[model samples]
Target: MNFSFLSPVANAVLSHNELLSMQALGRKLRIHSVEEGIPDLTGVSVALIGVLENRNSVDYIGEEYDLNEVRKAFYALYPGSWNVTIADLGDIEKGESVEDTYFALKTTVSILIEKKIIPIIIGGSQDLTYPIYRAYDNVMPMVNIVNVDAKFDLGDSAKPIKNNSFIGKIILDEPYNLFNYAAIGYQTYFNSQEEIDLMERLYFEAYRLGEVSNDITIVEPVMRDANIVSVDLGVLKASEVSLKQRLSPNGLDGKEICAVSRYAGISNKVSAFGIFDYKPSYDDEMTEMLLAQMIWYFIEGFNYRVKDDDFVTGNNHQKYITLAESHELVFYKSIKTGRWWIEIPFLANVNNKLKKHTLLPCTHKDYLDACNNQIPDRWYKAFQKNSVY
Candidate 1:
């Protein structure tokens, strides 16, 4: 209800009605405007919110940029066979200070999640990911972030937060809600040896671009385990997003990245999603269309979400318990969707944020490895993190 920080979409753009075709999402989406107030989100499944605070973006340019083109491209696309309702809540105008923008974003995102509405954020800079993480501080104490980028973005936390160094701020900041952080499509050349070493020392996960591009399905389990997914467009290859000023030559291609977005949407646990580092270019139809398709895939995947959160339903999942190296590993497979999860046991004497039986999304291969007397690395890392919390 506190949308005072928001600016509605431009009327001239909406008047075009490119999204008014039958079965298109634009026909169903409730658009906010100066003439009409915010939409009634009673049955809405996802809310699209745009932010216009790229001042903190390192090496910022193009002072006047908005999600207009992205919206136009997205609205023109037809919706899948989905029963989900979506709303475009318009853009959050840049505040007096960058911190003010963070405040507005955090408040807006947190309120949406409280209403069980997943917010799809189109952001100004990747640093906004910090506020997106903060939005879940009170709602879910233990947070896991999956970032799709070519760089680790783990700049020195001692310095001011920028688009490149915000992750460091999240890890070193107070409240310490972050339980695990995973960087997918990270190019080794882009990150320092020390940063990569730090990731291992802290039990944080990082997947090289090669590892995922080799097999995109491998990332489904990782995304399935995540709560907040932040994607930086800098990870895309130059050919995928030709208009970007500093596009990388070697990175995930358009199809691979869209697959990652779909995986994030399909996750039952993933609550907040963001695509950042988008700098709209003049007459760049490819960039706009690609971004729109990425969003469309995410929404399409969300419609296929399964109820695998509660294994106690008894009839919904098949439970498997395996003991290896004096440790008990429990795995569950959904009878309906065939998705898998591995349970990490909690310390009986310790008071932790995790429950007695905490399930982490995993692969069928993990269960096979456990049966072969080999412990899956994922279960080990998750168990270790849960123990500390």
Candidate 2:
């Protein structure tokens, strides 16, 4: 469970497939230093990840990579016209390995949050979802998670490892509990009977993909409660789409898949977002365009508002409180680059969270490290967030 997503030795070329250079992705993300240029909080933030099409560390030799254009097309999702916030995770530029790229992504999210921006992550692999959850919850409370996909991903049959089982590993290893978690459009074919039983035991709400593709209402409640979303593109069917690996035949169509993602983004609670499972190696160039289309839909949904990005609502109305011994609030410095930081608590009460914990560090890595020293392990355990997908 404590293992890294990729081997230290990349071992081959596909090791770098969808794993794009940071400058290439940064051009697509269009990053602006917040201290220098800032966007008005009239909307939400979108963060896309230009990840490798595969996650098991495959070594594809003769792979064709013309589909790199998909990243640019995907980046177009959050132009200012969308009236939404944008943060792209691919800001780290080229690296030699997946772990290097992973660290870069972890760093990018911290930068985005430092700028008061929420991000929607386009994924590298469904595996990358772990870091997103790890970093998102450190600074804010009232984090509601929603996953829209074909599989339950609740594999507990074996001991946790680098290659499989996200939900089991997240809950048992990083040790975060699911908080008001829900899911939509899951396929029965993807799960074992025992997995379904465990999901019910964990109190997750799930909908069948066949049922979701046909009825829009199936997703309403899940979206309504979610503060963040992590979408797996393989949840869609294999009709004109290409470049997808391990694509199951029993999921929703491309349009329905986009609709589901759009619904979650438009939800008033959604903050940080993630979308993974793009295998351009096996997919057609047109599939990248399809992926771009989904990203735009997410942007379209993110701009709708209930009140304002700076304010808190319903379930998470409590003000941020400094841990007993801490004079200045310490925070998650950033993502897995494994750095630490310090800030005087935020003083803006208009947003209770901002006012109480103003000068906190950026990512959850910072939060866990600081709290482990001051807060009780039980308290962190008590506030855990477990996901359905």
Candidate 3:
């Protein structure tokens, strides 16, 4: 069904020129003109999606960057990045009860996955992941998901599906457990002590703010394992994000945020990458520009991954890759149980079947681990020099 996209709403959203210019700089995909518009994503590979407008949800950023802007910007620059598409949340509002919206988004995201189109989700709240995750979780038994945020989003919030609790909800409600979960750059206040306890008990993978380094020691593996990646604007430091429904005083800075964004884009598992909590009510061009830059870097990384990450078949199992370029290969597979994953790694120099017939050294004494477990990357430690997350 075609939802009514009001003119006022359209005005609030970023104009095509703003996004197309970004495309011109990268110039991956070209459309007729900003006004003439882009193709209908006939053969797109990556999907940019978001709940553009919502009332009960936080509106600090307002709806300036709706799902359409996300779609236009990415497609303009990265043509065929998204074949399947859905614009806006269809009159969804925060205070209004709209469980149906969640279900619809879930179905749409699933469709994108089945089509092999990586999803880029820009959001109204962290809860937006509910439908996106539901869609992804249904088709893929095991998927690696990463959240770069300042809070755990433990499902205890003012609203059932507010930005904060959505990830918590997905983890608790999924039919089969996720492959692995990493919550990065969390602030102490957004979460309760009890929630932190639960996170520790669950052994969810995590990296405190200080733990992140340019070398990418903590985050690379998270990207390595994930089939899809997610980012919440709240994860970024206040200086980095001018607009946020709920702002964080302390978190990841601009450079770190950009690095993580690139890592997610490049990894390629990125069936769907979602960014939430950018409230335009507080946005300045500087912050929007930062957001725009982050988006560009992410698309560039995705371009590298998609152009490069071809799958490999093994005797035991077929391997699917996320980011298999720039010297290292990363892919994930499920073990006997639906809950766990086994990562098969190789130097990019090797062929796709590197894990199939060849033997590689286990970088970590314990190769298989839970989210919180830290496994040293031998490739990085011994060869790459500086470690990267």
Candidate 4:
């Protein structure tokens, strides 16, 4: 209830009451206004926060941006059959400096996480993800990040932070809370050969845009293991969005993007979700509606969340073991949902930060591959990362 760092939404954005006649989501939203102060979040499940700081956006340069239009679009949507409480805490106006804004975000999000509320962020630039990640410092020691974007955004950390290069800062900064970073739908051309090599050398995961476009479901396992998911609007094909600055000719379509959002919501481990790099459009209904639907699907998925992280009881899951050449691979499948996970053995005498969780979410194909005497790349990479701890 003490959201001291936030500013309430402007009355103009909620002035339109036409949505009331249609049973839309606008009616159900506990919107922050000048009269009511902050919404009581006692039992709120999801809280929406808008970051109006774009000074770090590498593409926006010196221009100013706003999320009022996107807010209007999102608030006009119809809520599906869901029981989860949602509130819009309004925008975080740009601070005197970019770092000032980061501090505000870090404090606000950290408090919400302590209250067990998932924060969905709409941002001025993708760089806001850094603060969102930082907010988890006191909540959890280490976390896995899944980015749905076209570029690696690993710009040189030696220089000041920009939206495109903030990841470099995250990976090298102190406290080193990042356990794993995964990039989904990265365009090879956008990333240099050296960056690709760096991904391999660091044991991080990156799936090319083509791979996921062909089979969108491949993203399920990756998202399932993530604690934070950051999405850049620039990853959408130019046809789907109206960003004049960066016109990506090819990327994930609206449907694929929504499915990705749903997968992030379905993951029990995912605590924070953000959509960034939104270019202020004049009157683009397509882009607005698409973003609204994405939010809708995420909430729908959250409403259907199941308790499946427990693997010791052996009551709701079936376990399978396979020998690839030298090491033994163990897999678990949920009897209720048919979802799969593979176990990565912990190193002896090593204290890992991954407390009480060693089973990595995987696919049925990984089990089939193990049965054929092949080592699943996911298991191998995870094992290698864990060994370093």
Q: Highest TM-score: which candidate?
A: 4
Q: What are the candidates' C-alpha RMSDs?
A: 1.7, 13.9, 10.1, 1.3
**Per-candidate total of colliding backbone pairs:** 0, 28, 36, 1
Candidate 1 residue spans exceeding 4 A from truth: 18-20
lDDT of 4 at 182: 96
Error of 4 at 99 (Å): 0.8
Q: Give the TM-score of candidate 4.
A: 0.97
lDDT of 1 at 353: 65
Candidate 3: tens digits of C-alpha lDDT, residues 280-353: 54335555555666776676667656322222444333343333224334333333211112343444663332
Of the two candidates 2 and 4, the one with more favorable lDDT, higher being better, is 4
lDDT of 2 by residue, 166-192 (tens): 666555543343454556778776788
* Number of colliding residue pairs in model 4: 1
Cα misplacement distance, residue 74 of candidate 1 (Å)? 0.3
At residue 278, candidate 3 shows an lDDT of 60
Where does the lowest 10-residue lDDT sum fall in candidate 1?
16-25
Superposed Cα deviation of residue 163, candidate 1 (Å): 1.0
Query: How does residue 376 of candidate 2 score in lDDT?
Result: 30
Say which prediction, candidate 1 or candidate 3, comes out ahead on lDDT. 1
Alpha-carbon shift of residue 106 in model 2 (angstroms): 3.2
* TM-score against native, each model: 0.96, 0.62, 0.66, 0.97
Of the two candidates 3 and 4, the one with more favorable lDDT, higher being better, is 4
